[model samples]
Target: MHTRTRVVAFQPPVCRIVWAPRFAVKSASNKNSRRASQHEVKAATLTNLSSDRTERRSFVDCASEDTLHHPSQLPDDRQILQGCESVRAPLNVAVLLSGGVDSSFALHLLNRAGHNVQAFYLQIWFQEDFRNYWDSCPWEEDLSYCQQVCKDADVELHVVPLTDEYWDRVVAHSIAEIKAGRTPNPDILCNSRVKFGAFYEYLASHQDHNFDRIASGHYARIIRGDDPDEPVRLALAPDAVKDQTYFLAHLTQPQLSRVMFPLGSLNKAEVRALAKAAGLPNQARRDSQGICFLGKVKFSEFVEQHLGVWPGCIIEEETEEVLGYHQGFWFHTVGQRRGVPLNGGPWYVTQKDVHTNTVYVSRNYYSVDKERNLFTCESVNWITRPPDSASQVLCKVRHGPVLYKCDVSFTNGDQSAVAVRLECNDQGLASGQYAVFYQDEICLGSGVIQTTGVSHAEIGSFVDDQTKAVL
Candidate 1:
């Protein structure tokens, strides 16, 4: 790790200044120098220059005072100020603390780095009417844990209520997608619409504090582009298994520029170790699973509470055979094997007929007519620059640890919609689920799956033949 010392000092109610070591710099005569000098003082200042009562802070990096000795050798405050005259100040960073081990550890790391860190917990779950069904919602417990962690770190904690926004943007959209027979990842939408979107705006609009950037516990990285005009790109975390770039693929360039992920480089084990070392209260707490706002309640139960239940027929795709009956097709997804009440061994869901309220199943999960190597996607969002249409890209259709090599091409001259053909067959490419694109470890962009070349007729004949042969 490069050793750069940071010195922060607040000047009454006006502003606070931070001085740090600069990068390598070129000669004064070089007009197009790219390197910054180590002797140069890089200062970030939080100035209260706005006429309104609110304090506004901007991150400005300019040339400042002469370079001093190493931070470890600094003797007095006077010398520190003298060495950092023309530099910018430290940033006032607000971290979205979820009361989980990841966010808590991220907050600890930021504080240790000597940044002005404040913790904000978004209150996104409210079950006033459906309390009976959602009694297991963990917002209260999570909030308590967040408060404890913030108190231990001696940082101010803000509880920002965003329940309405979360429901309107993330939960509502998720329910609608599932009802339409499409599998939607609510966590992805939550990160884009709630965590980075609404939460960030709330902090920025606050009258008291002017936060420079917002940080989260997501396991992803932001690599700054070399060109000033180029947007920062989102990259995979060092821990491949825990990388969350897929969930954050829909975020725009501006949303990403103001966000930071402190846990990008550390894996789960390392995060646990760091949390233990920092004496966080919830170091041993188990990781949360399923939809975040749903908490411990079953997803089906939650959906039923909102969408209600509709009886549907579970038919065998091969023979049009009614294998079983389901309470609702909306609660099920393609490629799902569990919770399917079928008498003949294990069955996998292959297709859904929303209009007829029917679900098609197959005994062999991989052998289905709906299985295809090609699909189409719409609503594409590129993180930085769009990749060449002819270039081969690695694509992930779901949140699992698999990445498939695929060929991508825009459809009907539409830049935002794409057709992707994989090297091998993949079943259950659910509509509304994002197909994230990548080149090696760098996430290029993603698009919502629109359609796939899955023919139910082809699958029906195969299943019928197999059954006749077995009989």
Candidate 2:
């Protein structure tokens, strides 16, 4: 049977899932109009999840349709205590600045320490309307945000427009990986390809080859080598709850040497505290979420804007019974249970067939289960080759949790479907996400997820058809 699922995406204000009230959505929509009304609504600020709608009704209510925003649980003070030993500051860094708190805060810390860090912001493909808002970031808003600090610290500020060619390199490749069912982490790719990519080339020539290193505000640590005898490779940041190393699993040694993470030692609270104390203006501003460059546009909004949406079916995993209709499949990720209307304890998305537009749901019973355990991946970019095909490894799927024991291997097991076999299976495994591999918390490498939960027979079937195309 064909696996691609179809979904029905509703228009904003009348969405099937009421993230906010209808009037609220309408008020937000009212602002998107071209005519400058006497009453301009507050700009909506949804990110990868949702944006804020001003002049629009309030979407962030206790009624609870907002699953995109991460829950609030600050890390403890201990988690932020990693700067104990005086560390070597980099000579220079090509930091990715979104003009938001994270990047902005990071630039301050690095520059204050006398490290050479040039900032760059990549503009993801956006509509003319939204694009104008973000333009103010570098030229008007974030430029001021960073300039004040950069001026105080006497550091130079640089901005690079994300050229059409740049998107082809970073964004397009990432979308392809996701469409093929691999969980592509654009943040990691943005750092590696954008900052460390052509941007690095531009900086070298611009600086007359004077700078020495690249730095940013990623909250991750390094473990450095394969064995204990080897040096520490970049591991999880000291702030476990906020450590973004899961996104950085793709960084190889060469990149690591040139990279610097000043916030590796600080937790979210600590960082905020420092921001406040440092007198950085955006410090108290709400933490910006979503795509780094896109500002507050929702992922669903952005994707629908591009690919557009269509009606689709929601089905039960076992019975394949039609449960309800949806606006679009792209709006959701696997393990999601909030929007789908099934009256029970809860149901997690077990599978999504893009072609059929079907979302398969399983009751939210097990934290981890066999159905969730079986996942496949491709676009495998390992920092170095794994020690063995099935070495015990610590793997994390997306930003859900810490590293768990898993057997690491690459197989034509699914053709175009590079595979990862987790030793202990978990429920709610979503396809089209990254499976970051590590050894004892140190990032080993990562791959894009292709398939999740295929039986031995299916694996064999894939091997037999390896020579053929996946679709």
Candidate 3:
């Protein structure tokens, strides 16, 4: 450990796995959304006070309700720890445990580092009254895993239940966003709604529990700070080999302040070495892949299981011929290839007409690309404030890739910067994803792509926005 940074709390807001450190530190970080619905607008106005300099967004970990033999839920288990409203403490830290390699390692490292540490697991939900993962894991699920880790660390263990309401509000909204042709920011929303909203809100109700910092198993970083005197906003981890900033660009300064990334300074190999040296049983455990806490299931597949769908048609890009049919229009994306019925040619999914199950396809970008280089987004959350009137900054379409030089512009309302044109085009880019701007790897802020325009070649002085903008 590079003498890990001391924990800092933001008053009672210690919610969201994203606000933690696991998926957060990629240890060569490769990588790096959204509008204000009514729910988001409400969150913006809420704030809390702290008991100490280290008050985190305070939250509780409620146990679950289970069947006969497995009485996981303990009724009449209400306890209040106070001024929990904010999470900004310096002496204590919490690591979200999922019983996987990343989180396990994170828990062990933090415990050993001598910080006041505890382990927590948010209970996952079940379908048709069946929870598939409760006992299948090699170690216990996050809940018990946290318990064991806490016992060893001489700390408390917390278990937050993933209630039915969470699926309806968080999961369902995520599906709806993706289906609406928007690159749904589920992990981001999950943090805001469940972790921050329900968990922190409830945790704040307590009058005694006070911890300062929250950590997780994410693989991203915070580069610059909201306040120059403070730590920089999270950045790609130092290892750079397995960065996950792409999935975490939505972190705002409010969340960043109370967050810590202990593994941010280490690589997977180093973590394994530490785990092995510590004789942790799960030292040899393989790192879990895919979205943190979300699991290995494909995004589209999961959405389909919950969302009802209707079949639709596929159309040829140039000829407008009805090539074939598909299961549902929502299942495909602008640059996707699978799920679209084969038509004997090297066909790719080029467009989706949601009103009708009509997909458009073509052999090349010129024929089927409909993205606009210039697009708009709302409810802007920026970590770095651009110099006033300094309109241009290098921006990145996503993580993994470096930022590109561009001219930046915003809408008249300027709710968020509305448009950016790359110095040039990149092939096969699509709309509805995210376009995060960066200044030398430091993420300024990010936005959902509304449209992408391209400029076609060979027609001098006659370039359309679609042809000019790369998608």
Best-first order by lDDT = 1, 2, 3
Q: Against the true structure, whose lDDT is highest? A: 1
**TM-score-based ranking:** 1, 2, 3
Off by over 4 Å in 2: 1-90, 93-95, 101-105, 111-139, 163-166, 173-183, 204-209, 223-232, 292-296, 341-345, 364-370, 385-392, 412-419, 456-471
Alpha carbon lDDT of each predicted model: 0.67, 0.54, 0.50
RMSD to the true structure for each prediction, in A, is 17.4, 14.3, 14.6
Enumerate clash totals for all models, in the order shown: 16, 65, 96
In candidate 3, stretches whose alpha carbon ends up further than 4 angstroms from where it belongs are: 1-90, 128-144, 222-232, 290-301, 366-374, 387-405, 413-415, 424-432, 454-471
Candidate 1's error at 331, in angstroms?
A: 1.8
Model 3, TM vs. native: 0.67
Give candidate 2's root-mean-square deviation (CA, Å). 14.3
Tens-digit lDDT string for candidate 2 (78-147): 3332331124454555566656676777777666665666666654444335345564223356557666
Is 1 or 3 the stronger prediction by lDDT? Answer: 1
Tell me the TM-score of each prediction against the true structure. 0.75, 0.68, 0.67
Task: Tell me the lDDT of model 1 at 232.
Answer: 78
